[model samples]
Target: MDETIAEALRIAEESFIASSGPGGQNVNKVATAVQLRLNVFALRLSPPVFGRLKTLAGTRMTSKGEIVLTARNYRTQEANRDDARGRMIQLLEAAHKEPKLRKKSRVNRIGKEKRIKAKKNRGTIKAGRGKVDW
Candidate 1:
């Protein structure tokens, strides 16, 4: 993960933009929000890892296979930059892990019987709500 992050950082492009939200006059004057863009193709991830990363990135992943992350939670540019880089690292790490295969579960015979019994009871109750004869 550390090596992946180092490679990512080496190819990442960072830009600073003015942040929006509570920060008094500083928000208007200073550009603290950091936008980090990294080309996922350059990472040379496997097809499976790339698929996972694609799903994880959602709209953040561009058609060009670049992942863009924005961090403005902090007031300082350096802090925001670190936050963006950290998020990117987290994404890469998560992609590296393989998802566990799900085991199919079946309802026990007793549980199925109970469910069918309750369904029959519900049907009976509904059948009782008939219109009255004149």
Candidate 2:
């Protein structure tokens, strides 16, 4: 299905420029890391979607209910930012998906009959294996 940008549900946030762990001058000079944040409670999504987002975000969601995503794999700031935004979009989309309801499953008539027939055959074989007393 096509997805439209959810401007109404959009969240504005900031990201800091920091070094990518232990690297020399290149890493220190270039801020390739991206950190994306969105307050779940502030989102305009339906209640069910917000609840599912809370569960899906797991530890990424803060105690106050904020969804955070960080992307640092890319070398450029723009690329990293896009990656983070894309991930957030995917996460929200997943949360918005309709959940499949569980339907009670009954034993199949054909399979049940086959299983019983096999059991009877196995029982006869076991009976023949019993001690042959007088």
Candidate 3:
């Protein structure tokens, strides 16, 4: 576990609920679904990282700036809990990375000429397919 993510997890809140799916009587008896909520604004992330995190969270983020994640794929509560925590860690790690800056690329003269020539050839072919003016 990363220190940053671990620190975030320290403040995270978790709850368990009954999962809806096939699991015989055990599903009704056991609360396997884990819901993890983290307050993004509470974390000590920079503004850029926080902005990116909010974007990446999409609908998972609440108006209060909390990110909620649910995991119910497993039959056991521990597994589901681990799954949810793993997902949060992954999200945090992605948000931690700085996005690559895009460089402006210029088309060379030969490339420009080739593109123009291709466009002209395509136009000529299309023109030849039309009804003859004669």
Candidate 4:
């Protein structure tokens, strides 16, 4: 296992529950859905990373700083568990990356002049559509 995933799993709590969906009678009998709760504080992320994670997680994150992820797409417990863990790791990795800074841009003088010229041309074309006087 990768270091990041192992670290994430170390602080994660996993629970299996009866999953709803197309699994025939097996769905009711077997608990296939995996609910993964990861402790955000355990990850020891920087302030910026934590903020980014909070934004990225949205409602999935609890007030106590735990990220909750449920996976029921897979029919088996193992698959669902893996899916949940993978998603949590992916989220953490994404938060670790810094967002690209945006640079302000200004249109050149010639570009602005061309835009104004186009508007005038369009206005003239529309004006030509008016009813002609007898």
Candidate 5:
């Protein structure tokens, strides 16, 4: 893992709660769901990365700038904890990538000609649909 991501994880807060889904009696008794909260602002990421992280987080990010992730797929608290950490790492890695700059591309002459030809053909078909004046 990257140092920054490691550092971010170091400061992240984690808690466990009872999962609502399967696992029979164990699910009813034990807290297997993990909730991980990370303060985005505290990560001190650059503006672009932070903006991307916020967008990627969507509703998971609270107004207070803390991202909350829950993992309940497993029946064990440790499994869920690992799952939550994995998800956080995935999110951070995604946000860490710099977006590719889109290059302005002009339509090639052949493509433009093909488009015009198609338009003319469609226009001819439409014109032929009119009632014959004969």
Candidate 6:
């Protein structure tokens, strides 16, 4: 019931039907599109899974946090269905993975000291270019 995708793996429903493809003049009449619907809000996924999914899905996630995938590449019904399912699995697996945490690091002391020293030297070099008071 959370925003995570663990709920997706638990409650995923696959519905693959014949696709409408380049099957001659009669292909346009058939329904060949593969629609992969992951009910993200229905399942109780972990916070990490949900976090990953939100990042992976980008703008694909609906306003309510649901993900809808549509596959209509192949002209054949079965091929299109398989392609859609494969893509859905890939997306889900990616979302299931945990991202590595960033480790904090300190600024290099030597680098900082060199920067200050260089600035002072540059100012001295510039001052020597001024006109003499005499």
Using lDDT as the measure, which candidate wins?
A: 1
Please list the residue runs of candidate 6 whose C-alpha ends up more than 4 Å from where it truly belongs after superposition: 1-27, 63-65, 116-134
Model 6, residue 80: distance off in Å is 1.6
Tens-digit per-residue lDDT, 1-76, candidate 5:
3987998799999988879887999988898899999998888899888999999999999999999999999888
Question: Candidate 1 vs candidate 3: which has greater TM-score?
Answer: 3
lDDT (0-100) at residue 88 of candidate 2?
82
**Candidate 2 lDDT over residue span 1-134, tens digit each:** 12323641256374857747544676878776878778766666778877888889999989977777888876777877888888888888888898999999989899999999999999999989978889
Best by TM-score: 4
Order candidates by TM-score, high to low: 4, 3, 5, 1, 2, 6
* TM-score to native of every candidate shown: 0.78, 0.76, 0.88, 0.91, 0.86, 0.62
* lDDT of each residue in 1-134, candidate 3, tens digit only: 27769888999999999998767789999988999999987787888889889989999999999999999998898989999999999999999889999999999999999999999999999989987676
Give the alpha carbon lDDT tens digit for every residue of 10-32 in model 4: 87999999999869999989999
Q: Relative to the true structure, how large is the alpha-carbon lDDT of every model?
A: 0.93, 0.76, 0.91, 0.90, 0.92, 0.71
Would you give me the overall lDDT of model 2? 0.76
How many clashes show up per model? 0, 0, 0, 0, 0, 7
Per-residue lDDT tens digits for candidate 6, residues 1-134, read 22333455446555555455466664557767777777776755678877877788887778877777777777766777678667766787787766688999876999899999999999999999999898
Give the runs in model 1 whose Cα sits over 4 Å from its true position: 107-134
Please list all clashing residue pairs in model 5, or write none if there are none: none
Backbone clash tally (model 1): 0
Task: Show the colliding residue pairs in model 1.
Answer: none
Q: What is the lDDT of candidate 5?
A: 0.92
